[model samples]
Target: MMQFHDAAKTNRSSGKVARPRLLAAATWAGTVLVLSACGGGGGGDAAPAASAQVPVTLGTAGPGDAQNHLPLAVGHSWQFEGTITEGANSSPTSTTVTIPSTRDVGGATALVLRESVVAGGQTTVIEEALVKDANGVAVLAAADDVLSKALVPYWELRFPLTAGAPFVQLDKTGLDFGEDLDGDGRNELVSLYSSVQVVGVESVTVPFGTFPTAVHVRRVLELTVRRSSDGLAFDATETGDAWFAPSVGWVQRKSELVGMGEKLSSLERLTAYTPGSLGSAGASQGATSTTGSTLATEPAWRRVLRASASAR
Candidate 1:
């Protein structure tokens, strides 16, 4: 997986330009764009109305409550189409996030959301492996690019949430990050600092449809990378914004790195969503794939991207 905050095109002393990639971060490290932020005026289009009813409440919540109106349940899934733009080139990809199953984490049952993205003729997971429990939602581990080994966990968010509230950051800095960047056995150290802030209710338009009363969340991260092969280190910052609809989870998000001169940005928007059917009350279990999976596997995304990639 690429770093949601990785450099667009690194300038190598040996005259090599790194490939442009739209990646994911253990924590989102981005700077907010002039794009539609909550409470901003003259946005050209009127913000959508608050029609998306909250699956849960919109205000303060406790441990067992759904934070930011996010509905976490087995079988629940969201499909998104991602467009990553660098300079004048852009790459479109598809992703599906589903709660494959549950496991014991921190002594509590955690809903594991598997995020699979197909790129470069391969389907790979983000490696963060989102898990939710009574405490709240947690984003664990770095991407395969950052930590091919040691998993760095972050208790991203806790309950008792409210508008204009500060986020609960689990891990501020991670060290000794291991990943094979150039297929070499040795790489570098990746350290990160992440924070998320709620900007209250707002409306946003996405591919799926128009969502009203979308909970806007902003995330910022600072990454310090140290090379093991050489005594070299660099720091970069990133920012991203996500809109979550009640009961619908995340509807859209825009991610980009700070100080990037070009249009090196990635936009992901929801295309479809379905509530959990496996274990939710009043909802009968739906038919699953032969593998007992709720959503179509990687082959689906592969076909879509391949067809389009071939067309181009």
Candidate 2:
């Protein structure tokens, strides 16, 4: 099993908070808001190659940290095709999605565009959430303590199962990470945040070869804390796995939430990265000053349309 650190006691140069008191009240939380629509790609229609690279590494370090970093440029766009399973009781839902360039949104670390089944045909939408940081930038920062505090008993179990594996930043709230599967000395920690914690390390066997595993610890903070044995509390934890790339962070990831007498999972396969046109079009702006007010009220489907166009 993975060893979890005291989330409330870890380092905090990055504004890490005590385990959120009510994160468990939320079924899902993480990431940013607002992103221009993209167009093109997949098959012969793949969008033109982006001018720069998109950062896709994983870990709890700063951008400069070689372990977890991203090459994703400001105006880059990419496609994501996967399945969304609401729960074991529900049928698996397949989705073909994309994330718009990060160059035009506010407080956005990442944008997700998803299209899935609706009443009749399909629905496309964008999840424009916000990534809160001390500096207020949409950028990702690591806060091990905050995350550990949130994920409890369940995390203790899950963390041990899939240590050192890549997992998605369920929410654009900030941060992502990918492990360096290969031992070539390249840092592949993709993204990270204050709510998620990486505790211990493990080695597991896979189809590729032996890999160093990363124990991902996560839990939902209950609105009200129930006292457990001693002084500990009873909280829910969700665990998952991720595989590191050679030089890149995580080339693929699969995550799940198993707690509160239930389990949920999401799998993502990331291939390439590209810098979008906005980065080239507006060279003066930084990620923090983008115009993302549209995210506050816009529906997700509209964002999907925008991302589809941007890809083109």
User: Top model by TM-score, which number?
Assistant: 1
Candidate 1 lDDT, tens digit per residue, 1-312?
112334444322112222223222221311110111111111123242222111211123445534336676668888989876666778887878776555443343445557776544667563234455555555443333323223235445555344675552422222344442323355334434345677777888888999777877776644444333432334444566787776677788776643323334678889998878643331222333122222223212112212222211
Q: Report how far off residue 178 is in candidate 2 (Å).
A: 33
Query: For candidate 2, what is the TM-score?
Result: 0.36
Per-residue lDDT of model 2, residues 15-111, tens digit only: 3232311111221222211101111111122222221112333233432313322222334443333444544553333333223433232233443
What value does the lDDT take at residue 214 in candidate 1? 83
What lDDT would each prediction earn against the true structure? 0.47, 0.28
lDDT score at residue 213, model 1, on the 0-100 scale:
79
Ten-residue stretch with the least lDDT total in model 2: 33-42
